[model samples]
Target: MNHTIQNLEASFQDVKSENSVLKDKIYSLNSSFYQYNFTYSDSFQRQKQFDELQLLQQQQDYMIESMNHTFQNLEASFRDVQSANGVLNGRLDSLNSSFLQQNHSSVDYITKELQLQTQNLSLSLMELNKSRSEDIETLRNIIRSREQDVPKNITSVVNSLKLNDRYLSLSLLDLQNNISMIGTLLQEQQRIQSNQHKLLQMEIQNLTYSFNKSTILLSNLQTRQETTVAFTAGVCNIPGDNKVFSPGQTVIFRQIIYQVGGGYNPSSGIFTAPKTGLYVIFCTNVAEYHETFWTKIMINGSAKAGVMALLRSSNVYIYQSASNLVVHLLQMGDRVWIQVRSGNHLCSDSPETTFSVVMINGSF
Candidate 1:
């Protein structure tokens, strides 16, 4: 019984130690779980604050962009206002200049009229005063003569003198009325004269304006005549044998492109001037064989200018061209043409061989 009790005590001690170890492990696990939960909650709060800050920054960027757009719009509006102000200023200046011109003209006219009226009135007043003085002096002299010749009776003299005085007063009144009428007539005459002068100036202005219009129209007419009556014809590759031409013969141009004023004749190879004008004539000729080619520009069968070209033969047949040009003033119905002077084997098929005439100007 003593050995069994010792064994049971040892087993009980081992069981107690195992239970203590398990309790310690459970406490450590609880502490680790609490720490993890606190750390997770702190991290979530930090993330929420960061998201709010990013949203605020984006709103600020949008507001800055909107403000910049508004500033640009304001700038454009300012430029438009400045431009309109400048245009208005220009218009105002123009109007001011016109108004000043009209005002100056009106002032000048009024001043002239006033000066004329003043001069006329002064002369009229002086004449009226002189006449009145002369009439008074004549009346005084007549009265003295009559008094000397009157009877030496108080009653007769008083009665006759009263009648004479009354008649003299009436005549003076009539003279004053006549002077007033003359002044009125003078004023009317001045008004009529001013009106006539204004009419004359307006007519003169109209005449000047008409003259300017006529001058412009005349210039335009001359320009139109120059452009409308212009004639140009160029012919190339006249059909002919490779034969030498005489000096005065006409080079018949076969092709006719344009012949204004019906001046060119294909059959006779003549360009007749339809009107008196200046003409530009040109001719070109090419020689295919070894020969000296000569061409002439002529008017009325008279040579005005000439050209010559020499084509020398080599291993290959060499060809050359000759050209002549002349500008001359010709009368109406004058003939102008080109003729080969001394050439054989001329290149008639080539376009280089050409005759051209153009009337550059016209007279009357």
Candidate 2:
């Protein structure tokens, strides 16, 4: 029994010791957990504050940089504006000086010139007045002598001759009415003269054109001995081919194409000279009544020109047409064209409108 009790006591003491050790370990764990939680919370708060402060500093730096950039640009712009203003001011000063100088010089020059002219005019007027006074005095004396010595009987004879002579005088009696009439007549005469001059100029121009054209044609004919080309145009049939034409209805053979040939109709047509000077081309168109058909003497295509018997008043009613033009301005070996124009005309007693031409000789 004693041994059993002793063993039980020892076991009881070991169980108590283990309970104490476990309680101490639990207290140390609780304290460590509390300290760790406090440290973490404080650190978190400090980090948040630092981050906010850093963000604020960054924004401030960005703002400062933008303001600095804006200041630089503004300063450069201000400098440019200042330079431009200075230049403008210089130009304005120069212009003002130039204008002032020019204005003064012009005014002085004009004043001097006007004064000189006034003096010359005054001198001239004085001389003119003196001469007029002398002439009036002499006339007065003559009149007084004539009145004293006149024979009344001869005055009538003198007056008769002078009566018609008064019509030629350049004098005016009525200032208002006659002046208006004279002005109107002058304007009318001026207008008539202007129109006449214009017409004369036009006529001269037309003659000149014709002369130039003729001269050129003659030159071409003489110089260009060889012909270049030729072509055919067409033929015309007017009125009725076989029947007589009615009044106002004349038959026409128009646009006949003719080619260059070696010679004329050796038997039927004769190429004649029309003027004294150089002429070119040998061409003719026919003019006839329905009873007889007109025949054209053709050359090379459409350029022959000259005078013919068709322009007479008696041949006015004769039917005539434009034939192809024949220009024979070429060397001996050269070619030309023969073309016919339109063929038709108003039927009348004499309605001939034919064109013909020929070259007589070379140039002067």
Candidate 3:
């Protein structure tokens, strides 16, 4: 009986030792499972980030294509405007040339008419003087032949000669006055035409100046529009450590690192685009220990890119981080933000979570 009792006690000790070893093995297995869960969660986050980046690249390519199309349209419009301006200038020049030619031809015609009239007037005066001299010579030969009756005939002939001389003087004076009037009229006409030509030239100059000014203004406006397209912003950290967030809640990154061409509102956790352009956006977030969450980069409440951080193991508190990047074409006043798609808690350490945006190109 004593031997049996001792054997039973020995058996109990062996069982106790075995139980202790099994407990240790179970604890080790639990620890290994926890570690494996953490590692897998981290790896999954990284893979999601990579996938998001690829999606972002495709979006960027699409945006570039759209911008190229817009540029082409703008260029075509500009060329059309330039062509129209050239046509207008050519027409104006042709009109000016035509007007000048017409005026010059009119002046030449008037000058030729005046010259022919003056030649005819001089020839008529010479013929009248020769005929008067022949009549005087014939009258003198007749008077000598009739010398016996000279007293009565001489008185009448002298009176007739005096009357003829007065008429000739009056005709010559009238012709001179008519010639002077014609010359005065021609001078006045030329003056009027010259003044008209000057006025037309001035009007053309003014039109040219106005058109050039408009062109310059348009060019300056286009340049300013292109040069003023700039935007960049970066923010980091949540307000507190291990902050709980509900699905669809925006993640407010309160700390502003830098901002240029400002459009970000740190308090509201929203970024409004100030100009139409292609923009690159990135977000990185860490889920609190023992939490699984989905984070999304949202534009106007629509998801553009997303990342998931999942921790499946219970009693295993390991921080898991995920990141995503995207490129988007944004119109002015479009809003963007980061939101919790499905999450409970987020890591709120500085530099551990961040959001950033930058405009890569401006659209016309």
Local distance difference test, per candidate?
0.61, 0.42, 0.64
Which tens-of-lDDT digit does each residue in 106-149 have in candidate 2? 76765575566556644544454444345434434543443333
Better of 1 and 2 by TM-score: 1
Candidate 2: residue 47 Cα off by (Å): 99
For residue 279, give model 2's deviation from the true position in Å: 25
lDDT per residue (tens digit) for residues 1-364 in model 1 = 2232344344334434533443354345335434533443334433443354345445434644544453354345435445544654565566566667787777676557656655664454445445434643443454344334322222343444445556767978999999999999999999999999999999999999999999999999887655543334344454463244665566676667555566787777778887787778887777756656787888887989987876555554667777778888988898887777776556655455667777777754
Candidate 3 lDDT over residue span 240-289, tens digit each: 42366788888777777777677888778899999888888888777777
Model 3 deviation from native, Cα RMSD in Å: 70.1
What ordering of candidates by lDDT runs from best to worst? 3, 1, 2
Every model's TM-score: 0.35, 0.17, 0.35
RMSD of 1: 62.3
Candidate 1 has a TM-score of: 0.35
* Highest-lDDT candidate: 3
